[model samples]
Target: MGREFIEIFEEWALDYDKSVMGEHPQYVDVFANYDAILNQVVQQSLGTVLEFGVGTGNLSNKLLNAGHNVIGIEPSEAMRNIASRKLPSMTILDGDFINYPYISVQIETIASTYAFHHLSDIEKEIAIKKFASVLPRKGRIVFGDTMFKTEADKQLEIEKALDKGFTDLADDLNREYYPTLDIMKNAFEKHHFDVSFKQMNDFVWVITADKK
Candidate 1:
């Protein structure tokens, strides 16, 4: 469902890690507390994990280090190749949030970071329903992404970006499908997930949604 952004990620594969490392000026805040963010997600995750958008395998590496069985899903071939080379033993396949290969092992938790916004609100709901179908009761989804608490907060952030002469960042803010907290809460609740959100940085939040 989010395949339209695959080309952008494929082209950004080589530079993606650099950007996440706080080298990219516009994205420094976005990746702020990057290691901590991954750790938070990893800490909350349980058993086997299915990770979406394994860009450069940063979060995947963390999940692996935490001793969970990690099955990575990525839509960008270039990104997948990079992750494969980095973590040769992990099962990384070409896939996205709404579409992935069938796994023989049970998935206890679905995890992702900075990538869920690739889906629009409707697509997010669809994806949540798909995850509900895939998961048993008490199975969880731990995700971290850029989301605003309200529409006004989102607009204010966009204006602040523009005011700071961050045209590219503003463009990205407008371009990406970053959802408000209410929208995400509704999506998860509609599918019977007991969801909660925690701020990770100026721009990111960690979501722990346990299936009910």
Candidate 2:
């Protein structure tokens, strides 16, 4: 993970949920959709789950309540600490998905939400390979995030940010890679995953890929 990305999450840890959900109250519906999607994927297996970037334990808490054992990989200590508090029984580790150590376990599902976008395009490709390596055969990956189908589409959104005088944010958007659906599908397929997805909105998407 990049230093800047980790730092942002560290600072946002305290107010992350409130700011993210409160700033865009309409997104409450979207989060509900995310939760539902994750639930569906997790229900397919009875083994443990590994959630990448388990920010503040939102989805982790839900999974725990649902009786699935979960282990989380989070780069930000502040965010990890908060998540650990909420899910004391859960193993919330301190590393990003790209570099986290692999262990032999019966991992049935790997899930991430709104966090994978922090990685660059190449990093995402490498990370998926790591995900494939750690998971058991037929293990599934459930990912949700802001993804675009093309650079031109993402550019249009950045242009809107500039028009609103959010230059800093526009600059950030310019660097934050949102994968085209085809790109994601190809990457996962190369690693033996059968991919499928649903767009929750213009910006948010939920992808389900089962190991083949």
Candidate 1 lDDT over 10-62, as tens digits, reads: 88999998998989888888899999999999999999999998989999998
| Candidate 2 structure quality by residue, lDDT tens digits, 117-188 | 888778888989988987878888888787887778788867877777767657767777777888898999
| Candidate 2's TM-score | 0.87
Candidate number of the best TM-score: 1
Per-residue error for 78 in candidate 2, Å, reads 0.4
Query: 136 in model 2: Cα distance from truth in Å?
Result: 2.0
| Each model's total of backbone clashes | 0, 0
Q: Estimate the TM-score of every prediction.
A: 0.98, 0.87
